[model samples]
Target: MAGKKRSFGRVRKLPSGRYQARYLGADGVDRPAPHTFRTKRDADDWLAERQAELRAGDWSDPDAGKIPFGTYAATWITERGIGASTADLYRSLLRNHLDPTFGTVAVADITSARVRAWRVARLDAGAGPSTVAKSYALLRAVLMTAVDDRLIRRNPCRVKGASSAVTPERPTATVQEVYAIADAIQPRYRALVLLAAFSGLRWGELIGLRRRDLDLTANTLRVRRNIAELHSGKRLIKEPKSAAGKRTVAIPAVILSDLSAHLTVFAEHGADGGVFIGAKGAAPRRNHFNRLWRKACHQAGIKGLHFHDLRHTGNTLAAATGASTRELMTRMGHSTARAALIYQHATAERERLIGNAVSAAVEQARKQAPGPNGHAAGT
Candidate 1:
């Protein structure tokens, strides 16, 4: 007798003595199993599973993610609409870290095991932890987009804690050390250093400032734009990274005269001219300023401090002055409280100083208090 008719697919015996499962997809195209099965029952089982998936509305096209990871990743970067500096960094990360291993791999074939092994290989290859973290984050982000686009069912980047770079606590400069470095630098960059250290302005913000942004009478500087310097020395002027990044920061009274001197001597003539420029009337480049910063650090006897640390120092100093977390966030141009909390943590020393002063005041009050009479107790 003939066997009962099958449901939605057919199992056929191949010439190689294996069974192949084939079915028609929603698009009326013949879809075959990715691989042959050992037995007709196995092929039928596979077909049943596919049918169930379609019935449950959980089916996705198996061939959709056949595109190469590199091609998709490059396209993802381009479509992201990121700034020039960010695009440059992403391209560098992809070229240096990611593309070598998974560039030609199908996006759907990137397994969690493969991702974990890649991370281990990167670490063994002596890639810095920070670089590895950044690469991992970029890879994860790309894969997430692939998932959202239905190119893949799930992202394979499941390595725990692989995205956060473990940066050590950055060293902060003392007030005298800040002054020494400012004084030791070229005269044109003196106010630059002072403003960065006191106002918590980033390198991009300081370089993007114009004469009109500075209100000397109000002692405040408006941060409306940021200039990103690409690896090729191309400068792209753009809006601040976030809305909170565009703010007016009050300059300390001590730095006003230095800023005035800088504006008069080194800044450009018109109101819209750059606030900080080189002696030759060119915009400041990070690479060029790095050399000057290193020399100034050496002359000032300060070591192992980065220019970004100047902003850190300023935030810590602001925290020490009893600024609230919101105030610190606004001053630091940060939208999140995590960075402000870091500066708040640095206020432990200030807490101790306050405690000591309070104890001393209490002691003096006790000493002057009357003891059983109107006379001073210590006297």
Candidate 2:
């Protein structure tokens, strides 16, 4: 019989000094794989170990193990659409920031150092800290899914301090400033501003208001839906952000009267029973309202005021009326007491005035009573 043929496979050196083993199987199929070793002996050992595993039917293709971060991220996003607004934001970030860097990198190769470098690059590219943090969060979430899928051993994004520090932008406005802005606005938008300032409604919530949502007799406004401007040149009506957001707020008597007057005068002829329609009775766009708001502010000589500030103004005024924190949270649909405190802080001056009144009352009582004596009458 002829001697058994040698079964040694061809070996090639990689640019990284690692050797790749290429071999023809008994079935005449060719396979190529990385040995992940520097020395020839180590490579040979790895190859022998892998061949034995193949013989034992326990071999796993190492190349097939590595999944590109971009591919995994896309799959995760498709599987879980976080929310319409959040998904849009994530898509923008992936297209503009993440895909460019880690799109081709293997999910398993994504180390904490690599992630930190990416964050540094983002900051070097003049991205804000908050933008960088959000990007990191998105990447981290994708990698976490990889861990769950057994594609990666660990998520590098979970490293402490991997996310950049971001300063939160202030989101509050004073009541006086909002009123001054409303007073200077054109008559068409005046009621709109008043409605926002008094109702604590979001921009979408205000624009989505139908005539039926308001009850003048009952002095209540039910917030059932919100209208958003989509990329499709038309409005999309969506449910409110939370269950608490779909609440019925008691309209102040003043706001009810204004709404009754506005309906009879301006919005009565609009289609769709809209309470605040644009010119020619079209569904109002947020941009149109924002532009009008800005122009009104400019004319009113008010600075640093935004249209959303009207909601803040409403919260501040409500807090000044001695509304408890719970009441304020309920009215504003704030999921946490921390958010309600922002509005309460805007009324800090009112708190100081109350403090002064209490101090004066204490001083009066002290003066009217005997000092250091148990006297029944004034000394």
Candidate 3:
């Protein structure tokens, strides 16, 4: 039988004398309290809480929020529509970081406290800061989607600065060291080293370059695509990572001659042919090049340097040219000014040189003036 109406919601007594509470949801669908109550007052209290949740706009679908973390996470990843490399990275994160702890937990059950504990446990397990940050970022993104899907009221990723990775200072090669390493490499790859240290192009971009990408007379290379090899040995060719990555960067006058020589001697035929190829005329993979690069570095006495550091050297040298941040971004094909800022900051050695020059200028100025300790011109 129907019972009395309350200020919040209607409560009715069932045939078994238990009370049932039902409230009209903000979604316009009437939903019952999660369970039956022994007393009318108990049912009324349950309805009151539901009303408050609705008023606060924190009410979510009870059924939808019950989805398991792993199930929803998989759905979220599929709906993201990201690139293949990015998809692989997210899958790796799920497999390595998230699934073990949160997979069975319901989305609604996730709390900020649990998230903090996860981060602490990851760090204690020897996970690096960058790895943890990336994992946390992926988790945050997925949970944000859950919030949008109305599966959860709020995201549990409350830790600030947990989404950004902190990288150690990258070591760069000097121009002389670059040349020494280039000279130590196979003659076919001499131009490769010069272009890497001078152009700021990434490995994928370099390996993706074709004969048509270079404008020899104009002394420029057009960056349009990139190629990456997955750990599973699958190779993917895709557009540049960012809009700014597709750009035209000029080659140094000195590198022009060497590039010309490389093109004449080793470049494969046809416009679509790769500008850089391995021993068998196939595009060079990073693993295959790693062995040769290690040998060259060893021979040049710069064994600790990674090939990616050549880009740092190139950008730093470009900054030394007094290029503006915008110009640096364009030349370096960086989407943000942060990298340009890093390149522009003078090195400690350069700072010392600047200090010495300033001191010398001050001393010369003092000697030229009629100071108390200095002789006058007509004294």
The most accurate candidate by lDDT is: 1
* Tens-digit per-residue lDDT, 106-168, candidate 3: 998999999999999999999998999999999999999989888887899999999987778
Which regions of candidate 2 are displaced past 4 Å? 1-33, 36-61, 64-66, 158-165, 168-171, 231-234, 268-272, 360-379
Candidate 3: 10-residue stretch with minimal lDDT: 370-379
**Across residues 246-300, which tens digit of lDDT does each residue of candidate 2 receive?**
8888787876766787888777453458887777677777767778778888987
Each model's TM-score, in the order given? 0.90, 0.76, 0.81
Q: Distance (Å) between predicted and true CA of 25, model 2?
A: 16
Colliding pairs, model 2? none
In lDDT terms, how accurate is model 1? 0.91
Clashes of 1: 0
Across 38-109, the per-residue lDDT of candidate 1 in tens digits comes to 998898889888899888877778898999999999999999998778999999899889999999999999
Ranking by TM-score: 1, 3, 2
**Candidate-wise lDDT, in order:** 0.91, 0.75, 0.89
